[model samples]
Target: MSKIRGMRRYGFLASSIGVTCAAGLALVPGVLAGAAAAAAPAAPATTAGAAPATGPVTGPAAVPGSTQSLPLAPRAAGRTRGRAVGAALEQGLRRADVRHFSLVGVVWDNPATELHGSVQIRTRSAATGTWSDWQDVDTHNTDHGADPGTAERTGGHIRGATAPLWVGDSDGVDLRVRADTGDRTDDTAAEPPVPLPSGLRLELVDPGDTPGEDGPQTDQPRTGDLSEAATAASAANSGLAPLGATEIPALDRADTERELLDLRGDELTDAQRAEPHIGARPRIVTRRGWGADESLRSPGFVYTKKAKAAFVHHTATGNNYRCSQTPSVIRSIYRYHVKSMGWRDIGYNFLVDKCGTVYEGRAGGVAKAVLGAHTMGFNSNSVGIAVIGTYSRSKPSSAAVKAVARLAAWKLGLYGMNPRGKTYLKSGGGNLYGKGKNVHLNVISGHRDGFATDCPGRKLYAKLGTIRSTAARYQGR
Candidate 1:
């Protein structure tokens, strides 16, 4: 008679079956004789009167309609209704503010009696304060039914409803039950609980608004405006046609009568017959004076009275003695430039050979000359011209760079200079010439800006921008 007086006599006969089943059928046999006199068992009745136990003892039954009692064995009333349905699903997953979760297994549905499962939650990122990890799930309640009969009615109603199978990085686990009375318990279920595991109902999402395919995309162009628009679309598709001052070529009269009949006499000298003569004198003498034993007659041409332009120098040496190949090897380089560098005959005012011949140096006409070496504080109103050899490491021939670009566009249109805003020498120090100063020659330059060596190296100073774009397409700019 005791199991707490048989659960208070089946909780007062289930509170009098709604007032004795509303007084009918003679009050159901006086409410089964007042539930058999309230489970009559005056203590001494273990064996002497075991027959006294009647209604209240329907094999530990009571809940036909309520004050919960049924626990004699449907596996101890499914382990007391799985610990009151796992304490009402851990108080409804702690009122649904679920924490890091994972369950993944539960699904009852016995034809829509519903009970779902499957968890994988991850929260805790109040703005990247970090947490989220193992995500992936299913059974989020498509009317919760067959997932092994909702994990055997959530392991017979829920108490530690057999969860743990989330294999990685182990966390607070414990669920993996099959218990529909097959009793198995690893128990540890109480903290902040609830019926959560239903893919923990997703909602936090914002790892920078998550859409990934590995992120970032846009930026690339400046290599100097893509090499100046590929050098102005390769100089407007280069078929080359622009120089128009009526295409200026003329000057031949039999090569100026065989270059003034190879300048008559003891191979000339006397400062090569005192300079002056230019274009029509191909027996070329090109003098360099003032050192035949010094004496340009006392500062005779010390920078020819402060010259203003002309500073070109290019004899990167190497002459394999073919001195223009022969006329007695060009008179032994005209007596080794009138006896060894002590000039007076070859300080170039024009030389160009490797077969694009144009010799007469230190002469005059190429807009008047005055040979005083090439550049160095504007070598006496300059006029150097030399193309004897060593174009830094070979590259002249295209008919000797187009006959030195047609004698530097006909001597920069006979020196009214301004080959694109001049300015030549640059190791600092200002104007000895004009436009951007320091030896401006209005056209050609190089010899490493007037000496201190490397005479025209990087392959003819990389063709000085194609000889200043062929003297700016022959000054038509």
Candidate 2:
């Protein structure tokens, strides 16, 4: 069983062009905000709307790795629409010759709570040729407005800054923007001019401090414990172990039949075979435990019971071994969760071993209501599945990944789980697994996100987007 954690919060704000400020405020410099923050909030726009179009828009190439500062002030007092400013910035970026980038804007409120502002850019392409259609990357709102002092200030001070936006595959363009309040009109014609760098240096900041060190300076107190925990967990769980040298028990032909029988009509033909390979055979059920009482203590425990969501996790234990074979390992995991870490049973409702064999953990038939201990708040409506190895560093075999996908598809069909079109991969503070803002499927996520331990590694988490995408494809069919 794998440990699960919560998600993080990242705040982004948009301001008019002509805002100027320092560059140390984008993200926590030297720190990767956690996986918790990596999960995007409900985006107001379509997921496909987040990225720029493939063709070129219009405008000169903005310098790579340079700040394009803008100065802005509301035409009327007490009226600050950050969205309008964000739109202008998006247009500006689209006009610039940068590609594959992350854009962020910050609005700083003074002691009296006036909307002073800043912005930053991190690009992975050089400035050349024409601009591409601007895509609004993900945005977040930190609790900076929660502070009475910072929230009450007025007088729209525009101080924008752009961090050294690195064009990873290109020469690394740099662009900057500084707010100039001299012109106070609502139109771009009255806005301040853009700043271009004479020459730029593509210096790489330590990945650790990239967030906090690069953006506009702020007095906002940092809460980074969750971020650190997410990072550690991701690091620990990444990568797959080499095929273990030890030979373990193989699934009997009869046992395979029994497992498939449980699925009824959904079982695949290949799913019945014990050894598709001659040398090694993967076992589906290594061990089975029954509680003292037959009524409530069936062969399996209910990890979660929900008809809508699917929770995915990696067995932090090594790959050469199957989790079913090691009941002690599962017991240790459960003890740590229930007694020490404070969770119900080992988080997952079902466990998948290295050989792509599925074992029942929390059990409830399709007819009877099944509940799981997988996701914290939503377990009552989810099916928790744990793959037996760390996939962050090691990729799950094609067969294993495919097996999990197929199982999820079957479960989704059986349970009537709607494709929420929201990917839960961005679980732990937005850092656990996957990439991008769009959630392709409803509630499909990795384990490290729900708790603090590194159950599923990075390499495995990266594939989550594909998994959900595939699920969506299947569901569409």
Candidate 3:
């Protein structure tokens, strides 16, 4: 995608983040005043030393490491009249000459404004001069993998950041945004006109060779030295051996009759290691198996005994990737979540590709309640399973849905949760549910059910019923 050739850039207005209430949109006190007071140094309209060009330039200059803010101006191509209220209006599109960048996203400074817009981008394929078709970028996204009620939401480089979409191996780029005006139910007579968001930006994340470029690299596991005594001690204390660390190679295995005989009780029991938590295990590529470089994430694992539910989500990183590129996609998301969003690790506990292959997401054992940063208010007891692409309007592949069922059956059954049943999760805040609020949700639910936004998309959400039923069947219900 390319940035618009020439447009007058303006420093966008930065608004403090507002709370979403049942009544309607409400601004936090002194938020606007504080934003207005500190207008200067908010953020420059464009990168310093990079001059605006007059026309579209084909080749891009090598940018060492930069997050340039390209201001988008309203274009006349947008339709207004007779347009349904609250529907997102395509504001404008901008293109820039960014050579060799792996990640792309839209950013703004208005936290007070609920900007619901979708970004579509077309990238110039390096292998060929031909351009790719425009793909959708989730605009209603607010999840930056930040811890609930934590300053990571309001602090760091993500205060007003929209979810960053991934576009691998691209030089040319173009982006467009449409502010969501639907779902508005305020008393217009009493409330003043809501201000539109400003300081529009396109953050390009180029972290070099998509970490683990030479395929997946094996490293030391999360646990310390893997010895007979150590394994027994850790297993006795933790109730579960660190076998999940197998793929990462934290410990070496020396097969011997004596060693095999010694492994009798310390290792995972045959029943505990079986799939479906009841029957044959489904195929799952571990984080190490999928080539995840654990070096990019924080150490230590957060767990909750057992998983009660599975929250489905879309990566929202665009759908321009191939099944073969799934590893790279996961790696990029891992980096963005840790380095950019400042989370402990990748948010989701598992990721399913369109091809139906399931990959382990956060580092903890697949069977444990490895608390994920997904589903803002309910990450603790739930496992977040993110399908790799946007499914708002697009239909999820049958294989993908089946993969979800297989995963839900295996994981949910670990705690004896029927996929078709209901479960209660205590909210951790950062969503429509109040913190400490106990919310009853479907055992298999979309991200929207817990939050107040559209996630897992309508298409994917619609498939939850089938997914649940299939998952139940997989559990031999």
Comparison by TM-score, 1 against 2, better one: 2
**Cα lDDT computed for each candidate against the true fold:** 0.31, 0.33, 0.57
Candidate 2 residue 284 Cα shift, in angstroms, is: 7.0
Q: Candidate 1, which segments miss by more than 4 Å at Cα?
A: 1-246, 253-376, 384-391, 401-450, 458-477
Q: Considering every candidate listed, which one attains the maximal lDDT?
A: 3
Q: By descending lDDT, how would the candidates be arranged?
A: 3, 2, 1
Tens-digit lDDT track for model 3 on 1-477? 112122123211111111111110011224422432332122212222222212222222121233444566665544433233232245445464665666776656654345555566777655665677887666665653544554334443443456667767776776666554444454353332333467666665654442244433335333332332222212211211223232311111111111111222133244433321321245566664454554455433444545788899988776767786777777667766665545557878889999988877886455455657777667767789999988877899999999899878766764667899999888877657788988889999998898877788889999999999998886667
| CA displacement after TM-score superposition, residue 2 of candidate 1 (Å) | 99
TM-scores of all predicted structures: 0.18, 0.33, 0.64
Instruction: Give the Cα RMSD of candidate 3.
Output: 17.3
Q: Give candidate 3 misplaced runs (Cα > 4 Å).
A: 1-97, 109-113, 116-120, 133-135, 143-147, 150-158, 178-199, 206-279
Candidate 3 global lDDT? 0.57
RMSD of 2: 22.6
Model 2 Cα shift for residue 124 (angstroms): 48
How many steric clashes does model 1 contain? 24
